[model samples]
Target: MSKPAAVAQAAAPAAPAFDVARVRADFPILSRQIHGKPLVYLDSAASSQRPLPVLRAVEHYETALHANVHRGVHSLSQWATEAYEHAREIVRRFLNARSTREIVFVRGTTEAINLVANSWGRDRLSAGDEILITHLEHHANIVPWQMVCAATGARLRAAPVRPNGELDLEAFRALLHPRTRLVAVAHVSNALGTILPVQEIVRLAHARGVPVLLDGAQAIAHEAVDVQALDCDFYAFSGHKVYAPTGIGVLYGRESLLDAMPPWQGGGDMILSVGIDSSTYNELPWKFEAGTPNISGAVGLGAALEYVEALGRRAIGAHEHSLLEVATERLAALPRLRLVGTAPAKAAVISFTIDGVHPHDIGTILDSEGVAIRTGHHCAMPIMELYGLAATARASFACYNSLEDIDRLLEGLRKVRELFA
Candidate 1:
């Protein structure tokens, strides 16, 4: 994604007017002080602070609807099953997926990718087959395929990212060959904040008859994702990144593809019937969702999606973009400070480094100031190596973040520079 030329020419547009103070009030943690200073949370890309609605939803489910699903005839069991399935429906609507059957709830993005790699890649890919991916992928996307390749005798190939942190489309096109079995890449670069051109990537891969999977952990909250619109075969995202509980995430697969793939795991819910000789698997999603699922986490995720919809995704994006613009200008003006990712278009993440200051030191000093930011490789070590950096201090934004948060971050960075100098 590239910044619009209009924004570069004129004053960056003001974020659409909203009652941000009221929004802030919904998150109780935001009100607390850290180190005797108001917490300036800018690490949302790592995990967003859950609001009242999500917290309440989880509480309600635990208190009132606590029973094993799809097992018993009791009222509590029936009610719990309804709540659990209803959460699946919410996930289906959230992604604009064609059917609820397409949504598979897992522990998080990492588990979801591993599920695909084990269930789909391991069975289908053979010797000499290639699994195409991008250099911008998170470790969750990378290691799973590597594991599958080693098991299946398939090769793993990565497309290059340009110096500006954008994917090299031509290189990606060239990499898609006759032996390519799958194309898995990040919807947005987790470390660099570069929103990858997923639509184009999908188009190119589809033209070559290869299915595409997107690691959408970073894009789910910041971008409007319609699986039907994107036409990707699979999309994976973590609930925590989108203001939900930590243990829940989603894998949205095309119903046809999911139906064809074997169950990733075998356990209680995933079986239609179990015999000593052979076991029958359940239908589409439940097959992949073996054992006891994260029932409360799914409830919280549904509530979080509802909360985000009520706030309006477009409005939240605009506000974050405004914050990004302001932070970029301020950080650029500071001497000896270098921005790592400068893609033309980006989400609200900013990765930067100051001369003579280690990123860990930057994070520690920011913590002392009650300003939270992520430091180190951020689970994308390949990206760190790409830019010739060991690590970078990353400040990421979310709906609850305000311009004042950026101010505090800058103040902390200045202190870090002075201390180092």
Candidate 2:
């Protein structure tokens, strides 16, 4: 309920040489005490806390240059519009998008995927075609494609994962055929933290002339996402996952693909000309964004991206990786504890189950100890079913997380075991 840093401040560059300790200071929530002790946040996969720079960027835009973008003739409108459009270029650079026109802002990853599936899928898919997704998919990626498949009388099939929670590339290879119109998969698993073999998947899909939509909701913050290098037709991510506001997200698509797909919705900003009988659609980016857009959110997200870029990608990745290694070793040392999703390459997520306790109970006990972690299916239930489990206790990390946070989670686990005993 407590929003961090309500006061507006100027954006700060990540200290010249950037120290992890120094970076953590930007997050006020991280410094607060919880349960009479320091709070240990381990749920970045759910949503990350906004850094001071990102918060200030949003505040500055709202206070100094507040106006609707691309519609007004006043000076404030020009300033606001430039700032809004600048956010797109920022995202384009952040994601290594081929062009700024490829970046489409929406509510979040969920809406981004929905927009593509409904707009592109509806226009391109036919009854005999099929969409190939993996069991590792979150509901956002899985559901939208399913809706498209159902509407078009197309079929949906899941590429299975091995028991270790890694996608079976061999199985995924077999699923690729002429009818496989699209391959939708997560760049990183939300529950398992599996950094998927996306490039290989993309190469395979591209060989078959099939497009790929990558759900980068988890990967954007932790790993380097290069749409040009990955050659994915679409990449979607949420701002909240990257220390930005809840309602902002990005959909990066190839210029040709975007131009080919019709507008998802018809409204003020998404059209060229409107008439009683018919309406003409706008170009690439704008065609996807209808109505008054989340211009403030875009600025905040760009700031979040800038903050991360300044932090140095390698440093953040190394810091979180070290924390995950510590958490993994500590949790694995516990008797009767089973670690789920042991993919060789993983992000900061650590999902494990104690011998007899339910994941829900574990989550409750952890929260009581002021150590936050996600429990239950983690929105990938089919993946759970594949592993012969209903759910897992997940402790996901972010740049703000420290080694002590992992210890708190371990302490919380011990408490849960003690109470049940």
Q: Estimate each model's TM-score.
A: 0.96, 0.95
| Residue 139 accuracy (lDDT) in model 2 | 88
Clashing pairs in 1: 1-345, 2-345, 3-344
Alpha-carbon runs more than 4 Å astray in model 2: 1-18
Write candidate 1's Cα lDDT for 1-421 as tens digits: 1111111123445544655676788788999999999999999999999888888888989999889999989988898899999999999998999999999999999999999999999889999999999987899999999999999999999999999999999999999999999999999888989999999999999999999999999999999999999999999999999999999999999999999999988889999999999999998889988998999999999998888887878878887898899999999999999999899979999999988899999999999999999999999998899989989999999988888898898999889988998
Off by over 4 Å in 1: 1-16
Q: List the global CA lDDT of all models.
A: 0.91, 0.88
Which pairs clash in model 2? none
Best by lDDT: 1
TM-score winner: 1
Question: Which 10 residues in a row give candidate 2 its minimum summed lDDT?
Answer: 1-10
The true-versus-predicted C-alpha distance at residue 160 of model 2, in Å, is 0.8
